[model samples]
Target: MEYQAAPARLSTLDANFEHDFAQRLHWSADTDAAIEQRVADILADVQKRGDAAVLEYTARFDGLQVDGMTALELTQAELKAAFDSLGDEQRDALTAAAQRVRTYHEAQKRASGESWSYRDADGTLLGQKVTPLDRVGIYVPGGKAAYPSSVLMNAIPAHVAGVQEIIMVVPTPRGEKNALVLAAAYVAGVTRGFTIGGAQAVAALAYGTATIPKVDKITGPGNAYVASAKKRVFGTVGIDMIAGPSEILVLADGSTPPDWVAMDLFSQAEHDELAQSILLCPDADYIAAVQREIDRLLPEMPRRAIIAKSLSDRGALILTRDMQEACAISNRIAPEHLEVSSSNPHQWEPLLRHAGAIFLGAYTSESLGDYCAGPNHVLPTSGTARFSSPLGVYDFQKRSSLIEVSEQGAQSLGRIASVLAHGEGLQGHARAAEMRLK
Candidate 1:
């Protein structure tokens, strides 16, 4: 099993791919002053004109003849009927996805962390509590990219974690939603569905409207304008992360078939022109085989243009000295999806300190994780997995500290609290807690 052995240098690829799939890294570019000014104008008009302004922009941007009534809200009855109308097989599939997703996230749920009662000279108790948010807005991108998987991924964890209002927002082109999206929303148990989308949808969710209520937070992916809208609205409402085009890094050896790697690469590349696909191999021979396989597979694909552009532009067959070096390169990239197609995926599993999602072995493709594998498909891209995490129930839920100091505890705690507050020129703070003690 021969493979590419070491890089003479990373000549095939440049360094700035770290910023985005494109060499120019437009994902991180500052919003144009003109763009910000336009957004401000749209926001102000929408604020004054209400749904009329939203309708005008939706028509202009989305090119849909959305009725004012259809664009407003769905009744509870309509949502349930949609749930009931699901075909048996489709309904069963949705149920299966929901259970699998719930099981995986339920195990990850934290229970208020650890609590401790310390006895300094005096006895006192202190601890932390983890709670869930009451409401969250999940924006599902519609039009050409109507992903029910997103509806499932964004809502299930919130349900499991006990969010009271799971406000599901998806832009319906001319008030028409994809059935798959509606089905997923049904399975995930969302109480309301709003037929609004795009930047206007983000604005409405962040600020609230006569018809659409405000949400505590927003999650899910969208286009550049949607991302920018989320960025602008962050202070008013919490956001999961600013997403970029999808990306995947595969570490393969000659032991795996080249076709498998090519197909895996296509799964991400097909996402968009900006999506990234790369391979790191120790043997030069294997890199050539994989490259050949990608070319052969590219023309036959439905979205061949996108795949070709992504591979030709963003991808690199980085030659490394060994598997260790491959792992080191992966750490630097921190890609959204990492596939270890080596003979021993377990060997490198421990080395995966960063990655939005990890796929082990040749059979475990990134596509499965994107759909029914039970993990979220909404992940951090553009090297953000270095610090951020994939969207989960935690993204929708906000936690508050639970403080219920007993009379004894407060009495014992009062002097220190008062002294600290007084020292900080916050006598009111001192008086409030100290007076309670009295």
Candidate 2:
């Protein structure tokens, strides 16, 4: 089918600039009620029936009819075989990406993942003990699109954090397996692999099944069904976040080529019809040139239909008064990926705060960060970067406060605790502190 994409054109000087900008930037992450209900039913069933429910859902959703869960399990030998089956280029790329991710997370672990303790003047010990979750589940989207890079991004960090077991779940629709995904599991040190997915896989990971071990946390992105399931199972088991559609906001100073900016916009638009790609520039001529380049380059894309729909519906070429205004507008958006495609990117870097990842300079494409840039590709979306963070080694690990009050320290601390407890009308709490004081 033919497709035509026309991004919204807006100027900050317009009388209704704020209203138009708000309308253009709006995208609700809410899932449909029917899908939510269906996901709830699936989660409840999986909780009750365990492996049986997972098998049933796999049969119904993935077309992988199986009598038992064993048929759904993939052995490490199988994973290794899949790795061996890859072409030389694919194998080399996977290995290189995994190493870079691992190296970066190793640095992150040293910076923040290590335990720390300090002794106060009175000899009271206070500290934080950092510990990785015992087991973590990484959900890799499969069947139609196999993101082996996701396998590297999610698994390597958990591994770096010293998680004992890393379980991987991917759907094998129609019993078709993606070799690269299995190979990634093998390379990234997945403790186990299961060819079942959707909300059922999430349920099994959250509650545990006869075949699948319960995980301490679940991480990675998936479809709307998977996102809804993650939201539901959050308290029962820790989750990364309820990720929304991908987003990219480019603050171009017109130093970059117009065609380069257009193709960069296309990169994010190709992700899905809901993904958002916006350009903020001060130069009207540059904005026009970029639009022309978009029209010229779009037809050449393989996923042209998705690109067209996403750009036409959610994308924008916004004209700002100056670079300062563009940065201000970007901070408001809190986009998932922010690109400063300018001559002096560092000058604007300080003003740009609320982005999940920042690509500074005309040469740095957002795509590079998604794959081998050593930073996580799993980022906060739908303006969530304002409050949340990108997936990291820290997400796979947790902290516990360590407290040891010395006999000398107890006297001062006990009185403070007793006073607060008594003020709160808890006599038992007051007495407990008083008893330790002497």
Candidate 3:
């Protein structure tokens, strides 16, 4: 089938630009009510029945009939065998990507994932104690595609943060296991592996099954069922984020090749039909060139139909008044992946404040960041980048405030606490503080 992708073309000077732009950026993260209720049922059932529920769901949903959870479990020996079974090229690439991700996360851990305290003049020690989670469950999507990269992006950071156990859960529909995924689990230091998925896997992770052991937190992306389960189970166990459709926004200055920008847009659009890819450029001719390139290159893509629908539905090619205006619009969008495909990306990068991750120059494509470029591919989507952040070592670790008040410090602090406690009408709190005072 022939596929054509013509993203909406809008000029910033137009009177209806705001309305048109708003319409293009609109994407609802609301899950279907039916899915929510079904997920709730599944979570409750798994929470109640434990391994029996997990086994039933694995057979019913994944078509993998196992005798018990033990049969569904991937042994460490299996993971190593998968790693050994890979070709030299696959093994080499996986090793290289894992090393880069590990190195970047190690630096991130050192920069922020450490405990520190300081003593004041009164010998009052105050700071924070940063610690890794005891264990974490990483959900890798194994339905339509195998995401070895997802395994690396999610588990490697937790390992770097000193997480002792990284439990991995991937849905293997029809009992077909992806070797690369198993190899990635070996490479990423996954402590346990389960060939199960959907809300059932999430439930098992969130509320410990008899076999699968509960985790302190769960990370990684999954389908809508998994997402709904995560949203529901947030209070019981921590989740990375409730991710939406993928997004990429390009701020161009007309200097870089339009084909590169077009392909970069395709990179995100190919993720799914709802994924968004937009380009904001000051030059009208450059925008036209990108459109031509998108048309020319999209036909060559295997997922051209998906790319076409995504670009037609949510994508835009806006003609900005200038690069400054482009940067402002990029900030407003706060896309999951922002690419400054310009001559001097750094100049505009400073002006751009909100983005999950910024790709700094024409050479830096969003795909590079998605795979081997060190930084995490898991990012806040659907304008959540305005306040949230990309997944990192910090997500896998938590901090506790450290405070040790000396006698002199306590005397000063006690009076202040007593006054505040009394002001708040908490007599017990006030009395407790007064009791500590000299």
Candidate 4:
């Protein structure tokens, strides 16, 4: 079958540009009703039946049937063996990437994950005590593809945060485990790993089965079922985010090679049909050149069918009035990945207000960040970047405000609290403050 790739074209000067642009940036993270219901039922079953339900669902969905829960768990020795089994090149790359990730998160921890306190004139000591979670479960998606990088991205930060135990779950459908995934777990300091995924894994992590210990939080990307399960169990446990499809927006000054820009768009498009890739530039000729490159290079990709459908359906080559306008549009999209593909990226970088991650310069590709650029690749999607931020050491650790009031401090604070408590008509609360007064 012949492959054809054509992306939608838009011009900022068009009369309907506002409406057209709004339509392009729209995407909902909401799951289908059927999927939500199925996830709820599975979660309830796992909550009630525990390991038995997990085994049953793993057998039905993953086609890996095992009598005991022990069979599903992978030991540290097995993970080490997987790491040792890799060729020199694979091991070198994995080690280098993991080190970079760890280094980055360690720096982040020192910067923001430390406890701090201050004392007032009245000897009122107040501050925040930062502490890591006792245990965390990281879900690594194994179906359709293997994400060794995800293991590094999710686990390394938690380890840096001083998390005591990191439990990983990755589905090995048909009992086929990806060596690199296990190797990543070994390198990233995952305390334990289980070959289980889907909503059942999430449920087990949230509710704690006979074998799988309940975690304080669950992090990582997953399919519809996993996302729905995470949403349902949010209060019971912390989740990273309900991530939407991958997206990348490139703001070009028409300085980089057209092929480079085209490939950057393809990087995100290859993820799935819903993935969005857009190019915004002032040069009409450059936009045309990039379109030509997209058509020329897409046929050579292994996932050409997906790339084709994604580009045809959601991708766009937008001609903006200028670089400033391009940045404005990029901010509005608040894309998961934004590439300032220009010589003077810094000149325009200050203008970008919202983006999951900003890839600067022509050489900085979004793929680099996805694999080994050090900053976390688990970013907020679906315009959530407008309010949230990338996952980091802060996500795995919590902060508690410390207040130690001196006798003199309590008298001042108590009077303020007593007046407010009385105004709210809570006699017990006002009396409690009065009791603390000097």
lDDT of 2 by residue, 57-132 (tens): 9999999998799999999999999999999999999999889989999999999899999999999999999999
Better of 1 and 4 by lDDT: 4
Q: What is the C-alpha lDDT of each candidate?
A: 0.77, 0.94, 0.95, 0.95
TM-score, candidate 3, is 0.99
State model 3's lDDT.
0.95
Candidate 1 lDDT, 1-438, residue by residue in tens: 222212112422455434443342334547677777777776667667667777787778767666773545766667667767889987788788888887877866654222333433334445455567878888889888778888889888888878888888888776676777887887787878877777788887888777777888888888777788888889889999988888989998768899998888888888887787888878888888887887677667888877777766666677777888788878878889999997889999998888999999888999888878888888988888999998775665555555556677788688889999999999899999789786
Candidate 1 residue-pair clash tally: 10
Clashing pairs in 1: 3-283, 3-284, 4-282, 4-283, 4-284, 5-282, 5-283, 5-284, 133-397, 133-398
Give candidate 1 misplaced runs (Cα > 4 Å): 1-29, 80-89, 110-123, 404-438
Instruction: Using lDDT as the measure, name the better of candidate 2 and candidate 4.
Output: 4
Model 2: CA > 4 A from native: none
lDDT of 4 by residue, 1-438 (tens): 667778889999999988988887777777899999999999999999999999999999999999989999999999999999999999999999999999999999999999999999999999999999999999999979999999999999999999999999999999999999999999999999999999999999999999999999999999999999999999999999998999999999999999999999999999999999999999999999999999899879999999999988888999999999999988888889999999999999999999999999999999999999899999989889999999999999999999999999999999999999999999999999999876
Give the 10-residue window scoring lowest on summed lDDT in candidate 2: 1-10
Cα lDDT tens digits, model 3, 320-412, are 999999999999999999999988998987899999999999999999888899999999999999999999999999999999999889899
Worst 10 residues of 4 by lDDT: 21-30
Model 3 RMSD vs true structure:
0.9
